[model samples]
Target chain A: MKRIRMIALVAAGTVVASALSACSGGSEDGGKDGSDGPVTVSVMEFQQSRIDAVAKLIPGFEADMKKQGKDIKVKLVADPLTDDQFKTKVTQQLIAKQAPDLIDIGDSLVPGWAGAGYLAPLDDYLKGWDGWDHYYPHIKKAMVRQDGKIYALVHDTGVQNLFYRKDQLTQFGIDTAQPATWDDLISRLEQIKQKTGGTPIVIPAGTAWGGSTWTEGFQPILGGTDKNYYSLETGKWDLKSPGFRAVFDLYHTMYSKGLLPVQDLENPNPWEPTKYVKFPEGKIQVSAQGTSGWKFDWGPQGKAPIKGLNEKVDTWQYPGLRSGDAPFGWSGLGFGYGIPASSPNKDAAMLLAQYLSTGKPLADQLVSSGAASPRDDLADVKPYADEPKLLQAGKDLATSVYVPTGDGAEQVAQAVAAATELIINGKADGAQAYDAFLKNATDLLGPTLVKE
Target chain B: MTTIAATASAAAGPTGQASPKRRRRRTWPVVLLLLGPAALLIVVFILAPAVYGAYLSLTNTQLTGFAARDPQFVGVDNYTYLLSNSEFLASLGRTGEFVLYSAIIGQTVLGMTAAVLLARPWVRGKGLVGAAILMPMVVPEVVASLAWASVLSNNSAGTLNRLTGLFGADATDWLQVVPLASVVVVNIWRGIAFAMIMFQAALEDVPGELIEAARMDGATALQIFRFVTLPLIRGPVFLYLLLTTISTIGAFGLVYFLTQGGPGGRTTISAIYIYERALQFSQIGIGSAASMILLALVLVLGLVYVRLAKVEV
Candidate 1:
């Protein structure tokens, strides 16, 4: 009887131990107290290059936090991933309540994360923080959602426009002036095709590149329209807006006429060949690209930087749908620090984020990564002041168009991409593609939410 | 009759009744010691996740906030949604076609031919040829896909286009023209090696005596192979078919890198479909439903395969 009792006790103990181990919340302690031992703040980074840059700046942040009387220990969770993989991992982590204290949040992912309640609104924190005043109005605007909540701190801004090969255009006797409208742009593309007999222009398309086709390609074209794809005031998808069909028409004309490199768009690395290989060799005359393309792709530190590239390439604002509308570009915040709602060390995390968002750390990150800083004052700093090209590109921000941000915004972006892909791949005509897109949007966001 | 029973019981005594109890008590610890870790692993890694995933399939769980804070149980709504979705249905059909062409027909036929030819004693440099055939399978899937991407690219730099250029033909965009067929060909190239290795082992196991006996009976080489060799290897062939089919259905990395389910959703397999829905679109509930459907399809196919082939173990 004694032996049997002992065995039962041991077996029960084993099962309980195993259950306890399995049930443990993977070391995530909810932030209920802060006066314990050093508060560990988990920092998640997705991009490798950005991780390396951020890793170097963490010590500064930690020291600054320590000086401010917050004993903080920063745990770096740097997992390199592709854009799609990053989304899945971040969402899974956030849902499991295992998300890091501070995570890299892009402006594009802000609405989705904020709506999902994965991110904690930083409005309260920003109001008390001194760094908030230093941020430009556009930077502040880019980080806030339709709910009037600022979800993330602005670290870097992405400035994009139409980049053309000026020397090639001159050689082909093509006009180098800014295209006033879609017709003018099309005529110029035709001239380049007839004269150069190469790919006239290249815009990212297809399901491979995913949301970028909508952001980098369609949204810029959409920007030139009478209305945007989504209205922030009502938080609804404008699927039936003339801008929607016009964007599809633009793709239809470009694809059907072979003006764009339709075949190359299907390649896995669509941007690489066009930006690095074709653009340098004068095979592609024009591309809708970020203004930082010069500094990152064909500048001194770039991969396959061409000799005398500044003389070869010239940046122009992406044109409008009709004449008399000013050429505009798309600008948005890049990766910024956002504390997850489930963070155990929210206070410590916010402190570290505040420290890193400005001063030496921010300047270091911007310089090392070649990203434009959100702070206008940082431009007069050593590196930004020295680089004339960077300043010139930064000036395009005056005409930048910020996309709508709200719940279901990602779905809206995807709907646009699907429509554009349909027209570009010859799956459907503009009208048919528009109709299919309307149905897709209606299915995604119920008919009440989508203005079809 | 009572006397006979009494004598039998007297002979057996108490041992028979107590033996089973004694054996079970003695062996219980040993059973636990041996099977405990494996059982725990199955429960924790495989069974737990599968059960959790099945539970997730019945919800309105998305990657968005509603699903994040509180995932509502919608009870088969995800299944209904997927059923009505044309893209999901088309992807399922494409997956079936991909498995049939790449795994069942292409890899099996090509692998069997290579294995049979290489197994012959008269074949010279068999090792070299075997190594050459196994090259793609040995290389990592992602690396092989990237290398094949370069070779199969439609651009001016592509080897295929360059080769065609020498023949005075214009560069053919093979992948763009027929995206599914292109991925099928690439998958076949990568998979043929595994099939060859498996079939070659099975071919080698075929008894030489039977072949000689068939030959002695005036059977031709082909007849000897057909009559004697084929019957012996049918078991392995069926097993290979089962494994290859299941594996091919799960093939995502290679196809993902090569096409990412485009020109316009042509190459999107069930796995890619699940990924796009779950990860890209943040519709986890729908993705789970699709996954369950795929799992059921694989299971049904496997059951049918076993039943038809009458494979033992």
Candidate 2:
């Protein structure tokens, strides 16, 4: 009886100790990551569709670390919620100081995140990295935050184009050549409407459509305005200028005249019905879309491929606001990875992140999700060199600007989206929407941050 | 003598097998042993989070920006902002409409109808009928919403569209046109089975003589149902409404899946508004404040129901 009592007491004590220890979160040296143990670098990829392709980079990363005499293991963490929920999930984790080691963050989000001190500046790390010089100056410029510190590596970039169906243009007796000006573009839309009796153009609008409204729809047109939304020199958002008015005016024309499918823009998944379905079916003839329209959306491996989409779809550069001006395009937001300040193994994680940005892994991203590498040297690399169209697009980067997606840019995008939404819903016109947007932007960014 | 003793014993305590002092002494151990785990769970899981939420509501906690790093305590600002915020106010009205349409009228009425019809002796294949009625409850909310999304799709070849086409009408995207009503319809389909089961159980307990006497006294079926059947099942109906009202107010998945509170915020009910502010925009303080306000409203409404039902929480 005494022996049995002693055993029971020992068992109970063990159980209690176990429960108490379990309640304690974790320790760095408890076989997770320590000086002696293999460093476990947690890498998060927000896009579920691209998770597998991203995970394939782990083995290569670990092997590279081994050659450097570093023991490392890469663990891939996917966004628990939908891809749309990345901002929320990442923000929550960062604020709680439980962030994953390396994060594939959107370029627009870099300023806010880095400013908030969630991200550790990559300037020191990049200075040590020999491969940093290969990135184009335009691409490198996008990586700099408001603090003039490089916060991330720009892995991939894309440019938007005015995609029009060739068959529709032929049937409508429209010109096969690119429109020279905003008026010319509007006239073509009018002709398509008159000839086909369908909504002829849809530049993505509405809040649900998110940043696409600003980037794909309005950013390219900013080249025509001869003004930028944010001036690095003045350090002020140019809300008071006629630049925004000219851009919104075009949207007003598109929406007020029923040129675009406003209803489809207001839905949850904004791009699907209009860009993917109607555009492919030749119901809606013209749209402003990223290179993904051919590379992913209607590629052979796309969710809904249009037969001979590359052959059928014709492209036009976005025209200037005036009748006599140069057309423009951009290497859009440098979608790349940043090391979080709370990351356990920042050095190991940074190494993995930088590795994933170059060569075959970056090449696969284009095929997986239409991400074009900003590194100019990738043209000589086999996988990237093989994809001639992607290579050509990368080579064409010298002609375009890096779309400015710096401090307070996402809010600026939201303000633009909200104003565009009002226009699309017929609640406000161009001038009224601009005023509303300016007021909203001023309110959000503070009067000191914005200038009229 | 035996009856008096039994009455005395009953008046002593619950089991009435022990002396009053002894029973009182034993109750402490019983309470600790039986209810301690449940009490601990409730405190840890529910109460702690609720208290934390209340505290968070008073701060300027954000998910990003400088505020996310070290949140500042700004007392009552979020609540004041909520009072003046047009979007949040608009969502309250939308939520009210959703609850009334989906819960009070749609689920309760339709479910009672099913229960009444199925409870009749002449009704055939009661097992199949019960299963059919319960199938919606068996289907997960996400699955149901996805199926409905496909059914209410914009495609001309969609299920609902094809059915409408059969009737010589053109196909229409019902979700786009009637966003609120479309969600209400799906919510009704999802929740009706719960109401049916509750009402069916109540109907089983209802005395048959009262319903029969009304019918025998030259009363119509409708009159008998209204005067006799309804009064008998009033408790069950009240219980169903109380539960369904709260559930409908908190409905998120169905509406989120179908519309995501879109098409110019047409279907953005209060829950969606909270989610948008808290998670989407990363405005934690405002969302928490909104959540607290919603909680208070629910609590008050629950108290009102308790006053009417004269029951415990």
Candidate 3:
């Protein structure tokens, strides 16, 4: 009995020891390798298509480093998740201090990550690069955080517009001219509804689409209004302002008037069918979409092959809130590579990011990945010259507004999207939904953090 | 083997008392070897994470910032916040309704009916019926969700809508119009097979003599099912309810793949709410707090199940 008890105890001990050892064995001492033998710099790219394109350029970077008498090993890690999931993954990595040396991020994510101190400012390094001056001023402005620090290198910029069915509009004898204001836009939608006899508009509006509703659906109206939601001078969230109410009112009108496809917007992929199937089939007459819609969504080589689509659809600027101010719409800052503060290979990472943001390699990657560069000089480049939609995107970038970077901007966007969804679903009217949204935001971020 | 050994040992009255000690002595090493790895896994994966999660619940830990590196403890602030937060509370209530409607009532009633019907020797094509009923449960959850989404889509292409249109009904988007009802039906279809198998096994063990005797005594078919069959399967019924209730409460992937807690939070069950808070929103403290609350609720339910099982015995 005594001997058996001893064996049992020994067996249990072995099992416990093995389990504990297995966990500890998986962790690596991966942070900061400054010593020279062969430095391994880890890069985390946000989207797969961009990463695959970047992966091809790694050898070029390595060869360039060799010419400069440096041996650097670049390890690229692609973010295999949706935008929301990517944010969570990056957060977990940052918290654990296991973050990669380089990170590919969107402009909306920049403010949140920068505020959390996960990003290393690139202003000093960017100044050393010759290509910095070639970047568009507005695009450059999008990368700077509230603290007046540039945290990322601008790679591509997305220009959004109101994409409409020109063939259908001409067929119906409705005016195909661009709307000068929100009321004009509304009247056009109403006309489309009366003539086309189907849902005339669709915007990204559901929780599944996350922050797109805020960026694509609501941001243009807010940008056109007299007062914006976030004030840089006071550093306060002003969602209760007239600007927010107007945006909400616009959605409420679209929903109440039955000018928007309420059912399609509620689908898991809110923008997929509306933009691809319905718009192409002339069912949805107008949609607010980005430059990608022209290049990768309905372009010649797009997933949905719409013959003569460029002729069928016409792109116009997001209508202004009133007739006086220049038309406005949200421009996605696309993806930019930045260094994490915790990265040990900060200098090397910065060098690589700078190289990837400029010249032939950057333009090549942009072309291969179906992205439009933020640089003005890239227009005369081969692929950009070949693609008319890319050239058109270049023109639209002059007036498009990127979301201003702030501490709680991502949260603000999500809150607005949720509020807009509430109204769109008929669960609450505009005013009640805005009030509830204000209360929710105040609860998450304290009342003092947000201004009423 | 155990039964035969016990019977033989009983014949040796004096040695029978000593046999238990010898048996334990011989069996303990084997038992320890078999159970040691399982216990270790439970401790390492489940218990450790749970304890750590509880610890995390008390802190103002976030995904990033100073909170990420060094989280500050704030006592029961997370718990207090959850109590006052209407969305969290509403999600908890919604989860209860979902489990009740989909698992307890829907799966049990339909599964029991199928089992009772198939148990009849006179029933035709039992093999075909059994396979068809069990097919949904056998399919991967993701595949099942995709199939259901395709069938119930609100588009002109959706199979169900296409069928409904033949009768002159409008091609309504079932997922949008009745999101919760659609999910509940899908879950019922998936879970019914498990419940049916459990009840079937229990009913087969029930003495055919007793059933025939009940019938000869002028007991109706419904009466036999209600008083006789149901009583015999009380233990298995409790077991099935316990299993299905816990699974339904914890279900996330299928519903998330379908609704994403969308159409204005109509289907935002507690599981989805917890995921959105902890993972998506990066509010680790709030997520952990919600997790603890869910764990406590599940525990209370398990205790109730145990007490009921004891009563049945």
Q: Which candidate is the best by lDDT?
A: 3
How far off is residue A320 in model 3, in Å?
A: 2.5
- What TM-score does model 2 achieve against the real structure? 0.89
Residue by residue across B13-77, what tens digits does model 3's lDDT show?
67456566766656656577768779778887899999999999999776643235457798999
TM-score for chain B of each model, two decimals: 0.89, 0.91, 0.91
- lDDT by residue (A1-452, candidate 3, tens digit) is 46756888888898878776764424332444566566777788766566777888899998999999878878888766767778878877765567788888866677667777888888888888888998988777766767888988878777777888899889988888877787888898898888767889887775767767776777766776654677765667776677776667778888888998887787777766788788878899888877777655776666465689878988778777754766665577777887888777888898788778877777776665456788877877775667777666777777667657476665666677778778777877778777877877776665545776
TM-score of chain A of each: 0.91, 0.90, 0.89
Rank candidates by TM-score, best first. 2, 3, 1
Q: For candidate 2, give fnat to 2 decimals.
A: 0.50
Model 1: per-residue Cα lDDT over A333-355, one tens digit each: 66688888887677788887877
Whole-model lDDT values for every prediction: 0.78, 0.78, 0.79
Q: Report the number of clashing residue pairs per model.
A: 1, 0, 1
DockQ of every predicted complex: 0.36, 0.38, 0.40
> What is candidate 3's DockQ?
0.40
Report the CA-based lDDT of candidate 3 relative to the real structure.
Answer: 0.79
- Please tell me which model should have the higher DockQ, number 1 or number 3: 3
Q: Which residue pairs overlap in candidate 3's backbone?
A: A32-A344
Which of 1 and 3 is the better model by TM-score? 3
| Superior candidate under lDDT, 1 versus 3 | 3
| Reference contacts preserved by each model | 0.50, 0.50, 0.49
Give the alpha carbon lDDT tens digit for every residue of A342-424 in model 2: 77788887888778877777777765766566887777676666765566567666676554545556667768888888898
Q: Rank order by DockQ, top first?
A: 3, 2, 1
